[model samples]
Target: MKYPIMIRVKQKQIAQLVSLGKRLDGRGLNDYRGIQLEVGVVGRAEGSARVRLGKTEVLVGTKIELGEPFPDVPNQGVLTVNAELVPLASPTFEPGPPREDAIELARVVDRGVRESKAIALEELCVEPGKKVFIVFVDVYVLNHDGNLIDASALAALAALLNTKMFNYEVKEGKIEVKPGYKPLSVKNYPIAVTFAQIDDKLVVDPWLEEEQVMDARITITTDKDGKICALQKGGYGYFTTQQVLEAAKIAKEKAEELRKLVVKG
Candidate 1:
């Protein structure tokens, strides 16, 4: 499908400028747009957060419940992530089951958190191989200006950081609720940075316009230790080995910057 003439013109203009380390939004090639974050947004949720990256916005809520652990990971708790692209968020989105983009978004976020071992699942187990706590991370897109993955990932992490565990006691395989609550054990902080390849140059936190003109996009996720935990590539374009390595280095630095914003000491 061909983009309308105006869109093509915009694409060409954006791409030309990006080749010169410039962006239509006045950001440098490696600069991210403004970010705003708020935690504990949902009173009824175990944890919740809202993150706005440029014009893009995402909300994440976490719910915890007692459930059986997976057979293979019987000793550890479960972590599941789901994403919804609300119709009001974008004209392109419609109300229905999760589309491919929504599924991909959830998977990317899940990989980052799971690979980094951000949540101390082992500590959530009530009984070995019998019962455990299940953490559900639900990501909702409230606006779609681009960089949804980064915003969603940040919100998920922030929500998890704000998560509180219910106090309970196990007696004869039965759980008894207690009056007090405790903070969830989060062992690591993982941050995701997404880059778009436009005019052969990679730009950080591409806005909606930049994303439409990009060749490929790749997301790099790093843990609290500055070690890479996950990587996902999308679009039809491919990055060279050197490009990937360079992106990794930049991603490490960017992750640290983003982590500080979402994680408090």
Candidate 2:
């Protein structure tokens, strides 16, 4: 999230437009751009999804493995999330270890699902503390226009919905795979909405141009029950109390629209 020279100049211009009650892309302060989502995009993965938000593109794949549950949560299954920012995604992204930006993206998406209780972990448990299904959610940033957080979250949720778990039977302390398969037990739907602060205005779904100039960003995740599940704020900017409330209202309104796209397997 380092600001380059050109990016800083563009951000200043966007801030000026925000002060005039306008956005760089001419979208309303609370309007989201068109979203495109597709499930089962990767044939090799058990479950996969791709999401495009404006110019940002993200892909998610889910893989399940049988393993012992965590000592603290033996009765429940485990959910592990990881994110990768390929060097080809953006010039700033390197080829080696993950940077802070990638870590933050993974945390934001993971918190939304974990806090929302979207997955029925207990259903994934096979034998209390002995064995359980561990769900691995991997997110890859194919393109970095802006707003990777929102795109990644959408892809993760969609991939989870498309996942199919193989039936298993425990015999003589050994787990055997059954012939039939069942869809992952998804208990709730969670959607994330991101807002960028430019000057004094908060704009929803900021494109790369606007993001380069914005001062701060906020993401809100809400469940199908209309309950706020998680909140994350990024960048070195300040938000007033009133602005935070206003952003929440906008996020709640937009979340419902996006939640409709999460298909059940």
- The residue-by-residue lDDT of candidate 1 on 181-226, one tens digit each, is 8989888999999999997789999998888778899999999999
lDDT of each: 0.93, 0.89
Stretches of model 1 off by over 4 angstroms after superposition: 1-5
Q: Which candidate leads the pack in lDDT?
A: 1
Best by TM-score: 1
Question: What clash pairs does model 1 have?
Answer: none
* Over 4 Å off, model 2: none
Backbone Cα, N, C clashes tallied per candidate: 0, 1
Determine which window of 10 residues in candidate 1 has minimal summed lDDT: 1-10
Please estimate how well model 2 matches the true structure, expressed as its whole-model Cα lDDT. Answer: 0.89
